[model samples]
Target: MYSRLSFSWTASSWAFALLLVFPIIALVYEGLKPAEEIFQHLMATVMWDYILNTVLLILGVCIASLLVAVPAAWLMAMCELPGRKHLQWALMLPLAMPAYVVAYIYTDLLEYAGPLQGALRDVFGWQNSQDYWFPEIRSLGGAIFVITSVLYPYLYLLARTSFLEQSVSLMQSARLLGKTPTQAFWRISLPLARPAIVVGMSLVAMETLADFATVDFFAVNTLTRAVYDTWLGYGSLQAAAKISVMMLFVVVLILSIERYSRRKQKVFQKALTHEDDSRFVLLGWRKWAASLYCWSLVAVGFILPFAILINYARYYFAASWTAEFFQYSVNSLVIATIVALIATAIAVLVGLYRRLDTRPSTVLPSRLSSMGYAVPGTVLAIGVLIPFGWLDVQINDVMQWLGMKGPGLLFSGTMIALIAGYLVRFSAIAVGAVESSINKVSPSLDMVSRTLGQTPVKMVRRVHIPLIRKGCLAAILLVFIESMKELPAALILRPFNFETLATYVYQFVSDEMLEYGALPAIVIVLVGLVPLIFLNRSLEQAH
Candidate 1:
């Protein structure tokens, strides 16, 4: 047994691991002061509402993603729908649309002054919202619909792969038993696909819990929105950290259920890749109807939002588009680019480290590092604050000792803070993508190199890295998309006078000016989709 870790692996491994673990520890430490304080706040005013809303949101997102993703995945994988080739890419396009962005777009269209109501007003000759009845766009149910519609891509991707790999023999047996196609799907295929659904749904559930932008935009008082309020409105990091831990508890439970559900299930073997020989050719009306449904889904998910955004972007040509705004965009691009590269690089090492080691310490680091993913962006924003404040204090003290002014606020307030925040929150995505791909690759490739007496580092550099290129690329794309769409953390952690598209939209929406927010909101959606396009393309080809 060589039992040797490379220098690059050791250093990069610990750096990335500590990068994730240290902030959480600091948060826990900061939060320890008043168990009573956070709890008291939780009990009196908003806890029940927060808890109830969070649960409903998670439930809604799960159901919605399943409805959209599972059927579409099955249809695409099992049935021969027209435009299936191009439609596959379209299905994933919605993944690029951020929840907050979609919420903004939906709210805009359905709002009293927006298109839908205006159209109704003209058609029915009604001038005010009071003149008629329509469902409120900002209500709990609306939040669920808006949020879930955009988040279902996770389910679509994972479930599609799972369905593609299902054994032909199993479905064949069901058909032989005279089960209808629909019955086969409901009974045989679905039961077997449960674990993959659980995996995909777990991500969506966490996403809903971790959501700050969508809930806040819809004025839903979920825990994530509460985390922001606790930290900013009251100046209480301890309270925020404690509340964050409450959300973390929910994530842990969902993950537990996921693990338990998946306990006996295995990723299907290659031999199980079955073609649907008895599958119905959806002909004439059914065929066109199926194609229409799939295409319409992509339309709502990708095209409609895009058209709306471009509509507002035209307004940008008349309004907020300026040299200064472009400069800020450049600044965002620079930080986003650096953070993506650094986080992905670190993720590669952590991913590789997992491949090489089975030690308890190594496994713990790998697992705990991903715990950041479960932390909502807003909670993570609060968690990162303790360290930043602590660092600033120590640095200022050093500056005082040097007979100079306090330490520069740049580290605490500006691009540095934003970059650090992105790395912490988004790196989990990067690690997941890289780790999945690494797992797919056979470890025997490395064994062959090792038997030839190549060093572990050399083995990775020459063998593992090249083979896992697709996974790495996918990971980078996922992280990049997520970072672009990030809202809660960026909203709270960004420096003075800084604005990303998400923050820009938030500023207007929070102020009750939906029109003011519409353009930037669209920009965010358009940008977020680019990587989603890449992600979906990767998924369709994953087989």
Candidate 2:
């Protein structure tokens, strides 16, 4: 009976995993089919531009993010600076500010007729366009800057954590050998932190590849924009799928490079002490420069855009706070809540299956389910519509054959599709959180429960669930936050007349009237900040 139950559980786990991964499978299948005319046209015409732009964007963002993040992370982790405590967490605030939001704010401020140029004209005593040259803020370079401003924190967080974990003795030994601080960092600290930094760079690269709103707003012809245009503008699913496959290729290449870079590299630190003596103290000019540099990132990334939103909200509150706004707020809340609950439940099941099953293949289900997180939102949306749309058609056909009026678009044209997309994109977060928590529970506990004749289900409910409940809560919050901020998926998958906060704000942004969307945009930022609190608390505990 035990063997039978175990086999049943294993089968169920595999089935669930395959179900989650089915969209990507379907996508690959569709993309590989004989090329439709639209796809062939795209390949012959503008596809090279798309590929080149995307590669450049990702490359620029990764390099710029590294330059910005590594220095800030090193300062926070290894140097003594005033306000370090507050600044450390504040550096992460920009993660809450969506790239599109920042893009709009900067464009408004730096446009030809905007205040910055207007003021420059006043100072230079010139009015016409030919008077002076200013770099355009709506170009690829601007997109790189805007994206790096927010995305640098991915590298900053990981690099900081790695730097914090390094042993003080290593730095001391380098210093004793007459190495300067910069030399020690280059020779000793950086090499050890390369794996962590590369992981951060891969994350930044993926995000740059996934970005649609920012790149689209800047008029950069990246593949994400190409996918969106091919699907919505041209109404060709096959073309969109083909473009999405190209993106997947880029994503796979990035992950492969990241993995290969760290394949044989491992650093184990003994005596991981971070006493004051280990820190390099900056004084006078250096102290001011470090403080200014860190604060500038926080200001440009979070404070400036956020403060502008507040100002807009203050003036436009009466117009922005209306029945429509409230309705969209409720819509966002309800959808995010549902996605969070369902994603968390799936995580618990997959995580527990891995914990209980001893076979090496047991890990595959978790991995398969987590793959969706790596897929760009635009690609995932296309992948989702293919399978669900077919299912909807089949359901209608079956109903019509039974002499009943078929329900129109049950899965594809309703909230179900949106929820499924969210699940595919964010279930990985819950799975990772639950797995981390479950790993902390000793195997002895499971053995003791088994010896007591507890069934796997009961043991999971009474033992593992209770132990990992905090992780479950964290997972729920993380998924909820991500779902709330998700724009591209929501934009693509939402049913007619459905408007989440992201989409609502995006509408105003697209119309160049972000003042009217300020309230909802602020809501997005504030809600996104919730996970950072949990993150900071975890880091503090680790410290």
Candidate 3:
């Protein structure tokens, strides 16, 4: 009976993993077929430019994120600064503010007729156009800046954790050997944190590559934009799939490089004690400088954009508070709730399977299911359409053959495709959370439960589920928040006349009228903050 049960679990796990991964497989198959005329036209005209722009955007964002994140991380982890407790988590708030939102706010603030440039012209006694030079906030450089501002926190969180985990003994030894604080950081600390930094940079690069709204708003021609244009603009799924294949290659390359960098490189450090002596005591100017730098990042990244939204929401509240706004908010809430529950359920099932089964192959389901998180949303959207669209076609054809009215566009034309795209993109959050929680449960508990004659299913229901309930809740909330904020997939896969808060905000932002969308934008940011707060508390407790 036990052997049969194990086989059942194994099959179920593989089935779920394959269901989640089938879109990418279908995408590759479609992409490998003969190219459409539009794709050939793109290859002849501007495809190389799109590829170059994407490469440059990734490189720029990675470099800029490193520079911003490393110094702030070092300050927070190793140096004494004012408001350190609040500043530590405050740095992460920008992750809640979507990059496109920030781009809109900053462009409004800095454009020629906008407040900043207008004030500068008035104060400096400048006349008309070309009187002075101000950096354009709608160029490739602008996209890099706005994206880096929001994404640096990924590197910050990882790098700070790495710095905190380093042995204090190493720093003390370096200081005793006549090394200054900066020298010690360069030699002893930075090298040890290199692996973590590299991992963080890869994440930032993937995010920058996946970015569509900010790049599109800025009118930059990157691969994500190409994918969107090819599919929707030219109505050629084949060309879109081909472009998506290029993006998949980029994603795989980034992950490969990150893995290769950490290959055979390992560092072990003793638990960091909560000792004040571990931190460098900044004095006078240095102290103020550190404080200013940390706070500046918080201000630019989160506070300013958020503050602008608040102001807009207050004045435009009457305009934005209507039936349409309410409907979109409800739509976002309902879909996010459904996706959260389903994704968390999948996480629990696969997680328990990994824990119970001892075979090496049991690990593949969890790994395979998590790959969608790294895929760019536009690419994932195309991947999803290829298979689900075909399924919809098959369903309709069979119905017509049976002399019945066809249910038109059942899968690909409804919320089913949207939710599936979301699950593929965000299920990894729940899986990672559940897996981590499961790892904390002792194997002896499972053994004891089994020895008591409890079947695996019964043991899981009574023992595993109850114990990991908190992690499960966290997983649900994280997935919910991510779904609320996801724009590209929502934009591509939403059914006719269906709008989420993300799509609603993007619509107004695209029209250069953010005031109308400010209220919904605030909702997205507020929903996003819940997970960051939970994450911060968890990290605090763990450290």
Candidate 4:
């Protein structure tokens, strides 16, 4: 069962996975320090508001997501209307947009000085904010709407897939039992899709918790905001670490609910071999309504915001077009490219270990490695800083003891920390992608190669790599896009004066000057579209 250096691979895999988790361990270790003074101060001030806002944000997103996603998913999967074909994939376009980008764009449009409210005031012959009532786009409710609009696509994608895969036979049986199409959907389709909905909500919940820029921009206080403010605002890393620990607890609770829901999920197998021609056919007003619903989501979530960014770029071209902008773009690309390669390599190694070695010793590392994807970037950044900062100090101390000039923060003060934080945060994307491809290969092929006197390493090199080349490319592309868009961790861990496209856009956004940053923000959205378009084509082929 052993390949050449199987021991080496197994040992290294475990070590690497452990290294990924060590940051979280470090956070917990640092939280052991006294934080009572900071905690008491926060409790007396904004802590309760943070808790309330965060909970309300999660609940609001969940409700909005369900309302928006379920009907859209049903329409795309089960009904055929005008442009239903295009809307099926168009609904996923929002998946490429960062929620913070959407927030920035919409707030710019809907706020008092923006076109929407200005037009409203002009149409109503109103003079000022005191002259009329308008919904504020910078409140908790606005944060919910902006984030949910962009993020509901997560729910839509999964819920649509679930709807498509539902048992046609069961739906037919419901119809046979004298139920109308609507009743059958309410009774059978929705219940069957519950697990997918739960999974989607869990994704939304985690993303909501991870959000810093969106909430920060809206001036909403959430736990993620509190962590950033406590650390960067108060000059207290200890308090920051404690708050991060608390945030991790929230993640754990989310994951626990996900696990429990998954355990109760019922899987339904397809009983019929062909498509049921009896799909709920829409006509007249219903068809138009369905079309309106699906198109509205696509427009609000992607098309409108994207168009606004383009307009801003056109109008503010001089402000946004400069050498600094080019360098920021290049810096982002270089970092994402590097992190993607490293994360992909780690993913491949750990994935191969799991495939070739069945022992618990080898398997556990892979499982451990996958856990970091769920941890928030803020928590991951703090976790990274605590340990890496300590290690840098030890190295400098050693240099001083040897009568040599001490090097400054080697790992913590440079790109090393940023890349490390990225890998720890995003490697799971690569691991899952590669492992999926590896699993599709037949074990019999491996056995035949082994019978021909090939070592396991050689057999994998010969057989597995060629088969999963597409999957590997897809993994690299995905991780690259994610790294490009990643912000919180990059914000905390980047070297001073270093700027990625995300951080650059964020700077303008924070200063309320997104006009000058519009082009880069558009570049980010366009870059993210690469993988979404690829995945959309892939899903088409699969269907």
Which ranges of candidate 1 are over 4 A from the true structure? 6-12, 35-42, 121-132, 265-272, 276-278, 354-360, 398-404, 408-410, 436-477, 511-523
Off by over 4 Å in 4: 1-5, 271-276
Q: Residues 323-409, candidate 3, lDDT per residue (tens digit)?
A: 999999999999999999999999888888888877767789999889899999999999999999999999999999999999999
TM-scores for candidates 1 onward, in order: 0.88, 0.98, 0.98, 0.96
Instruction: Name the candidate, 1 or 3, with the larger lDDT value.
Output: 3
Q: Give the clash total for candidate 4.
A: 0
Model 4: colliding residue pairs: none
lDDT of 1 by residue, 1-543 (tens): 236586667677887788787777777776666666656867697788888988988898798888878988888777777888788677887876766767777887888878888988999999787889999989889998887777788898888877878877777787789876678889877877788888999999988888887788788999888888887887777788888878878877999999998787765544757564545457778778888988888887778877776776676555666565576566657767777788788778887787786555666556656767777787777778789877888998899999999856746677777887788887877888888888888867777887999877788889888988988887776676677678788888898888876677677666756455565566666677677666665664665
Question: Which residue pairs collide in model 3, if any?
Answer: none
Residues 281-373, candidate 4: write the lDDT tens digits: 788898898899889999999999899889999999998999999998899999999988888888788888877776656667777777788
lDDT of candidate 2 over 1-543, digit per residue (tens): 123247778887788788889999999998899999998888899999989999999999999999999999989888889999899999999999999999999999998988999999999898777989988999999999999999999999999999889999998898789987678778988988999999999999999999999998899999999989998899898889988989999999999999999999988897675666788888889888999999999999999999999999999999999999999999999999999998888888878888887767878988988999999999999999999989989999999999999999999889999998999999999899989999999999988998999998999889999999999998999999999999988888999999999999999999899999999999999999999988998898887
Q: Candidate 2: lDDT of 455?
A: 93
**What is each predicted model's overall lDDT from 0 to 1?**
0.77, 0.92, 0.92, 0.87
Regions of model 2 farther than 4 Å from truth? 1-8
How do all the candidates rank in terms of TM-score, highest first?
3, 2, 4, 1
Error of 2 at 421 (Å): 0.6
